[model samples]
Target chain A: MFLHLFIVNKSGGLIHHRSLSSKAPKLGTNEWLRIGSTFHSLYAIANEASPVKLPGNKKNGADDGIEEIQADGMTLNCFQTRTGLKFVITAEPNTTAAVDLGQILREIYMLYTDCCLKDPFYELEMPIRCELFTQGVENLIQKYSRIR
Target chain B: MSRTPVNILDRPLGGRGSRAETQVSLSAFSYLYSELVQYHQNRVDSISELERRLESSGYDVGLKILELITYRNREYKREIRLMNILHFVSTQVWKAVFGKPADSLERSVENTDEFMIIDYEPLTSTFCSVPADFGQLSADGYMSGIVAGVLDGAGFSARVTAHSVALEEGEANNNNTNTSSSSGGAQSGNNGSLLPPRKEKAVFLVKFSPEVLERDAAMDR
Candidate 1:
């Protein structure tokens, strides 16, 4: 029932992460930091590999927000309960269900934006610091942990 | 005297207590407005410059929104009554976008060629303080554009301009001392405060061209 979460940037590099279950194996701080930096570097490589450009001979200045790669995509996970707290997990090309994992990640993003991002206390581009996100995530992990 | 039937209270924000059809969150609105003001404030010089920038920005949004609002109005009913239409803009239209009605709407008594819609707090230019850098950006002009679009959509042809009529201490008379009674006559820039009161206020001058007056007179005859 435990799930891992990773936030990969547009370049498919991991930026943030957490485990869905308390009982799940813990990653060392150094390991997590290395994973984040490595993923970030890989993301840059992916972007360079697929440097998007406009069609019809349009030599645009920069890419127009749509880019993807096929060499194993990143996965973002989230555990949620009835009250909307979410436990998020993310990783690079490691989940059995990538599409389902993506759906969960999108939902978590929505929740985070609605609760934490909208909250005045949360700063932009900072780590998720809202009590609601934490509580939701913990509750979801606990619920799924018992079920699984 | 066959007076035009008054449909003033037919609007959503009319005195009869009709509710708004849609609800918008105040936090979202304030946050958006704050960002808009900030965006317009950056790279502007004088207060007039800041007002111009904000006015221009609001003008685009106003023009688009006016079209949508008028379309919605027509959907509910066919031809709109003139007074009712003015009231609609002053109340429902204003409240729908800015969360409040205009402060006042006064028709000129002498020439009868002008009307003024006043708002004590104009939201478009709220928090717009000109920065010390690059001099030229009038938030007021954007707001004026918005007013012009709305008025034109409502069939009133007028040149809308946002003016900052600040009152220097002891210069109140020197500011708005000469109030004219004639319609479309020279408007005194000293009608009220420029910087929104702790709350904001905007005055929209709705001046009709000579042709519109002639049409109104013909309709009367």
Candidate 2:
């Protein structure tokens, strides 16, 4: 089951947050902000910490960096786009639904494009609170729950 | 939790209204714009008329974009000078719509009232290719309309038109040579080199109203 979602911008600011399950622990807004920045730094660190120049491999060793994290019976999956926007989702351990999580993240990205980026009244790099966006996320959560 | 439902369009767009970092696929936008051009093409008798329709459509968008961008920039005191507005359009507006600033912004050497913004490969024309017989038909009319709309919305009152400029064979060859030299081995593997050269250049000409010049002179005094 999905527990919470966080969208961190390229500059490591928390642009969005949503909690799907009531059982999820609640953190103060300040704590959430700190976590978002920490995750951003960890992503960079993970990329740099990749083993240098594997023998016989022409491609960069860090081609695919820090994609998932497992801790305390929870799974944190991170998907980074080419433009550097990060989508992080927390789920129950042993879900084995990485593909599903990626699809959900992509769908959320599309919704953001349509509801926020394309919006004539929207500002760039601001917190996303569009009604359509909220509704779309909710719909996805409900759909995923039923399927599971 | 019963509450009066508000129309989505009426809601505020900025601040905490929605997430602003979303992006749409370029292919989707290209398809939609192609249909828009085709729709206008069927309804008009002449190229100019078709362009007019496109400009009008873009004009509406420009007005809305101007407000949105201005609000986002927090520029409560709107730009009043002609050059400032043009710069804003060429840089800020271009980035907002196309994800990059315009390639060049130049004042017309022959006409003092005229200015030009050039985009080497316009987004609207990325997927469009006009037939040989169709003289001077470029999909950049939409961009011209956008420029006009932004100018008009900002009280500059200008006329904007899009023109296609075919690159000379020598210049085209030079460009290709430069690219080949830089990439060398990568050129052979690139698929883009296989396609024929289409209309890859566009110039948006903006002519400000005479009153704007008069106002500028007064301001200078």
Candidate 3:
């Protein structure tokens, strides 16, 4: 599946964007807005989403809910890393296909960590504010998506 | 002159005078800079003025670093030519303080006395959002001041200006962090630094005033 992406810094300024794969069909303007709006909604919901656990965390003295978002389904998933930076992933429906998509998203995150995050220009939470991360991910997605 | 036999480690190059190699914590420097910004805030009457004031502070640090570097390397033979001195300052002196040479240094072809030092991510500018109420103060002035102070002390009278130059598209972004700010953001400030994915890199332009060249020429006679 091809996913067109836009990265912006926390200031909401667009930093980088491109299609991830050749096979993934480009979503139209209406589709793109729908995805963004859905993603934003999901992100807010995800913050409240968690696995089963006690209401209060005694160990760290902080409340952390026990819930995991399944990687499956035709939906948008956004994950923010420890540094208050956000990551968004979208995939087609179902857990089976979504599982691979999830893995792919994780790989993309790792790729971002390795390539863009390591670049001095990539400021944290500033959107996919790093140019190098954008290029590296694009190449990887293109090279691997076709082969896979 | 304290005249105490300085540790051998202090001497970078084998020279007659002693050179001290002082290790400063990045946290300490950041805190100092923060305080300096606060101090400048008192002197300024407006919000943007505060940032301009802070930039001048960075410039002051730059100048001090340049001076200390020159003092540190006084034992080295005098660089006869403008280029020679610039290289020595940019590479040797700059590296000593900032831990790497500037990202680039260039002489202005249009003007004989103008030189530029480019820092991809200037330390003062990074991690700092100039708050409103400080007036037209920017960190750029501080960085420029440092360069100016260093050049002036080195017998090269010139103006150094620090402008924000972000390279949004370039391969140099990946490999150049080591020369930039690996140890730069360890702040003593409240907002803890997220570990740097890579270090910051900077380029400095050094220009020699015509007076400096003329003096060197006269010395040759």
Measured by TM-score, the strongest candidate is 3
lDDT of 3 by residue, B1-221 (tens): 67998686675543344322244445455445555665776687765566456545555565666555657656645456667667766677666655566666777788766777766655554434432332333444555666666666566776555554445545355434453344443332222212233233444445556788788678778
Cα lDDT tens digits, model 1, A1-148, are 3346554433333434677645445887567756655655543344356555557423321233212222344444334332322334544444433244444454556445444444433444445545455555565445444543
TM-score (chain A only) for the predictions, listed in order = 0.56, 0.86, 0.56
lDDT of each: 0.50, 0.73, 0.51
Winner on DockQ (1 vs 3): 3
Residue-pair clashes per candidate, as listed?
39, 6, 56
**Top candidate (DockQ):** 3
What value does the lDDT take at residue B112 in candidate 2? 98
Question: How would you encode candidate 1's per-residue C-alpha lDDT over B105-134 as one tens digit per residue?
Answer: 888677476677765445444334333243
Q: For residues B1-221, write the lDDT of model 2, one tens digit per residue.
A: 87888786776533444333233345456557766877777788987798789999999999988998888878887898989999999999987776567878999999999999987766676535454456777668899999999999999999999998876565443243333222222312143332234435788999999999899779888
All DockQ scores: 0.01, 0.01, 0.04
lDDT of 2 by residue, A23-141 (tens): 56698778888999999888888776767645653442333557888897888878887667888888887554633776777767765654455332234576776544666678777
**What's model 1's interface RMSD, roughly to a tenth of an angstrom?**
13.9
In lDDT terms, how accurate is model 3?
0.51
Which stretches of model 3 miss by more than 4 angstroms?
A2-19, A22-51, A54-77, A82-86, A92-147, B1-55, B70-84, B102-110, B115-145, B162-205
Chain B TM-score, structure 3: 0.64
